[model samples]
Target: MTALLDLVLDAHGGLRRWQDARTVHAEGSIGGHLWSLRGQEGILATTDATVDVQQQRLVFGDFTGPGLRGLFTPDRVAVERPDGEVVAERNAPRAAFAGQGPDTPWDRLHALYFAGYALWNYLTAPYLLTRPGVVVEELEPWREADEDWRRLHVTFPETLATHSTEQVFYYDTAGLLRRHDYAPDVLGGTPAAHFSEHHVRASGLVFPTHRFVVPVQEDGRAASEPVLITIDLTDISVT
Candidate 1:
């Protein structure tokens, strides 16, 4: 493993421990005006999400409204009701954006793909960097607000369902991830700065319980306006 990757994985919890924990469960509230804009308000708000860590799959739901259930994986996504009736589904969800730009019309399935892979990537963290086909390189330390942060430039394979193939991760001196920057292709190439805080340990693994994503300026600085997304996770477990 690269030195940077080694330090990050060890800080979050050893790679071996993460490998053994095949699943993670988290109860949380996810909210943002973006959801309402997409007509999926409250879809993931007040949710109980279970993630299959090894397989990169997620099943989430029990929302307040219609009690929607969702299943998401790299290949496809499906939403069902409490009665196990499939409501919406999309196969090869990534390909759905072929030749499409940021203005592509989004449906419920697209939202599923966006949320599914994004959360999976977030929850799996440094361990995800260890996967095959992920390329990581150390970058010069970033100095911000009088603190120095180690940085990594990562390139994900096309098969991986992340915001974009290229992303940058920033870690504090203690080796915990503090910020991530990416341009989400699905969102019309919107640049975002994602910050993680309020870390807590569960089952030997560390997780950031609070997360925020906001728009980034042309110069790669965070905007001063409202956040695009906010997620607060509690009651977390891994096994």
Candidate 2:
């Protein structure tokens, strides 16, 4: 790992600790204007999240209401009941966004794909950058929120479906991930600034328990109003 990556990982409980965990669980509420515009408001407002630490997989229980869950992975998206009965399933789900635009409304599966990969990426980072086929490079410092934050530009292999193949991660002097910038491919590559704060540790792993996403201005800073997405986590644990 790079020196910058090591610093950030150590601040977030270390890669050694992360490798010891298999799964992560959390209870959270997620919402914002993005949902409203995508016609999926309240879909993930409140739910139990389970993520695979070793793979790009996540599941939101009660996602479609009680007795059901939304499953997400790079290859598939599905809705199923607790009994393992799948209500619907789509293979190679990312292709579903072929002709999507910023104003386009998303179906439940589309929302499932977006939320699933996003949370997985968020929950397993710094360490995630060390994965095979992932490239990380430290960039010049960025002045933001009154602090000069270090930046990293990461490129993910096509096999890994994330907000975008190329994205930037900003870390504070203390090595916390203060902000992240990416373009949501499903939204026609709209620039976005995602902020991470209210950090908490669970089973020796660190996470930003509260976060919000907004538009990125020409200056590479976030616009203050109109929050696109808000995520607050409670009872986070890794095992």
Highest-scoring model, lDDT: 2
TM-score of candidate 2 to 2 decimals: 0.98
Decoy 1 TM-score against native: 0.92
lDDT for residue 100 in candidate 2, whole number 0-100: 77
Summarize candidate 2's per-residue lDDT along 44-67 as a digit string, tens digits.
878699999998899998888887
Clashing pairs in 2: none
| Highest TM-score scorer | 2
lDDT of 1 by residue, 91-200 (tens): 88987866765444567777778788888899989789988899999999988668899999999998788898899999998889999999988777778989999998
Please list the residue runs of candidate 2 whose C-alpha ends up more than 4 Å from where it truly belongs after superposition.
Answer: none
Alpha-carbon TM-score of each model against the true structure: 0.92, 0.98
Displacement of the residue 61 alpha carbon in candidate 1, Å: 2.5
Q: Worst ten-residue run, lDDT, model 2?
A: 98-107
The lDDT of model 2 is: 0.91
